[model samples]
Target: MKPSRLARDAIVLRRAPFSETSQVVDLLTPDDGRLSVLARGSYRDKSTFGGPLDVLTRGVADVQRRKRSELDLLHGFKITQPWRGLRRELTTWLAASHALELVRAFAWPRDREPALFDALAGVLELLDRARERYEIEAYLTSFAGRVLAIAGFVPVLDACVRCGGDVADAKRGWLSLAQGGLLCGSCSTPDRTAIVCSDGVVRLLRRALGGAPDATPGTAWTETVVSEARRAIDLYVEYRLERPLLSRRLLDRAERSPSREPVA
Candidate 1:
């Protein structure tokens, strides 16, 4: 029996050539979560996919799912938002890539994640307009924080994870990755596996984790605040995921390389 064809709005996450004229594509859809589809003859010049089927392309994917196989057949793709702005800047492009990598890592196939999909779409649209490196970093951090919370890994920032004491008024605290949140001064000891955190960092984390997915904070973050926020989020994510991300390494390399003119 032939499987029924399904169509859904999807964002391309990753793609690779599978054969001389075919490709394997990873996509994130609101209803389907993360999916792998085989696009036959997509490499051909007059392929039915119509436009370039690259990462970050938002489109409607027509897929035919087999009853016993994990890979689905992609009949066609109709592009909606190509996100052309991302191609104009290296930082923004890399930032978007990093976000997609996180989704690919954490999102499960066939899991319903409409909220996660909306959050990702919101962040990508913001990244398209971000002008500074700091803005890009801030947005990426925000995206990570939100996604982590959506995945049930919400970090404790309002109070001590260990003792439940309010640390909102405290001057300093400790971020414990193993404990999955902040620890008050009373609960944090010298031997604890934690990172010393300032009140400012805690506040930033609180906002990032709990703020609306479409909201960008108006606070002006100093280089120190930006660095600390990024470090904290990265460390927490790595600890939870049990490994570092490849896209993060690439992003670090790009940051260290010679500077280029800011994207207009």
Candidate 2:
């Protein structure tokens, strides 16, 4: 039987050159987790997908599911939000790219992740209008927690993953990526492997994990939470992806440099 073709809205996570004139687009759709589609002849002049394959660009796309395991065909695409403002700001662009990289790394093809999709949409908007570094950081932090949650690696924030005991009173806690959640002091061992976390970090994780979608703490704490949260989530992603994230390294360099230019 022929695989179904669907019209969906998607975010372009990454795009790579295919042949001399085509491009392979990796996208995150609401219904599909991660999809690789071939935008035929997109690199050539007079192309329909010509100006819309940018990372972080949202669009309505026609994707033909594949019978085998290679790139599927992109019958058409229409731009929703180009997010051009992000391009002018280096930090925002780099940060958005890093987030997108995580999306591509973690999500599986043909899986439904509408919540993750909505989160990404909000993150992009936040990155675009972010005035302070904390805003960006907060969004990324929340993003990391949410994405991990969506990927089935929900951390034990409300209570200990092992004993199911309340963690609200604990001053310091440990998060185990390998063990797959939080470990209490009694349950923790020398080789159990966990990240040292403070009350603030724990609370932040708890909020992101448990809070309502529309509810977020004010932007006052956005930066601090975002920075700390980035480190924490990166640790989890590093363990899960099990390889060096090239985009993260690039982001580090971008963060340090005086020249805030978007990397091509």
Candidate 3:
């Protein structure tokens, strides 16, 4: 039998050159977690795909899902949303890229992740319109929290992991990545893998992980609070994933450089 033909709404997660004229593209579909398809002659003059097959673009993908253990064929991809704003600013680009990296790490081939995919799309859309660095960071932070929680890395934040005492009831709590939660004043050890955090940061994290990562709390974010909250989430994610995301590292460096500009 011929390979089953499928056309799904997908987002370009990543892509690479293949066989000079062809390309290997990674896509995230609402119904299908990730699809790796070979786009034959996509770089040719008479290519079936219009424009460049760029990353982070959303489109309708015409694919042939093979039965045997082989790469699927991509006959066509009609770009729907270029999301050009992703590359309009360095801060936004880095945030968008890091989010994609996190998605790639969590998404399994052919597995369904509809909710995660929707969340990702929403976050990307918001990132494109974001002007300030803090706004972009908030969107990414929220997305990361959602990704981590979905992947079964829920950290206990309301109370201390060691003593089970609510941090709100104590003077303060220490964030312990290894123990995967907060340690109250009485429960924290001198040598534990704990980072001192403020009550405001903890509240920000709680709101972010709960949902609505795009919802801005105030007219403008409390710069310090949002930054600290974002940092804590990223550290937790890195600790759980056991490897630092290269995009995240680059994002940090780019953020520090005042002269950096968005790449076209």
Task: After superposing candidate 1 on the true structure, give the runs of residues whose Cα lies further than 4 Å from its correct spot.
Answer: 1-3, 190-192, 213-217, 261-264
12 Cα displacement, candidate 3 (Å): 0.7
On TM-score, the candidate that comes out on top is 3
**Which candidate do you rate higher for TM-score, 1 or 2?**
1
Q: Rank the candidates by lDDT, best first.
A: 3, 1, 2
Question: Could you tell me how far off, in angstroms, the CA of residue 162 lies in candidate 1 after the best superposition?
Answer: 2.3
Computed on alpha carbons, the lDDT of every model, listed in order, comes to 0.82, 0.76, 0.82
Query: Number of clashing residue pairs in every model?
Result: 0, 3, 0
Better of 1 and 2 by lDDT: 1
Q: In model 3, how large is the Cα lDDT of residue 246?
A: 87
What ranking emerges by TM-score with the best candidate at the front? 3, 1, 2
Error of 3 at 113 (Å): 0.9
lDDT of 1 by residue, 1-264 (tens): 544788889999999999888899998999888889999999889999864479988999998877688998899999888888776777778889999988887899978899889888988888888877777778887888889888888887877898899888988879998898888887888526688877777777877778543224466666567667767887788888899888888888888782564444
Candidate 1 vs candidate 3, TM-score winner: 3
Worst 10 residues of 1 by lDDT: 211-220
What's the TM-score of every candidate structure?
0.90, 0.86, 0.92
User: Which segments of candidate 3 are over 4 A away from where they belong?
Assistant: 1-3, 214-221
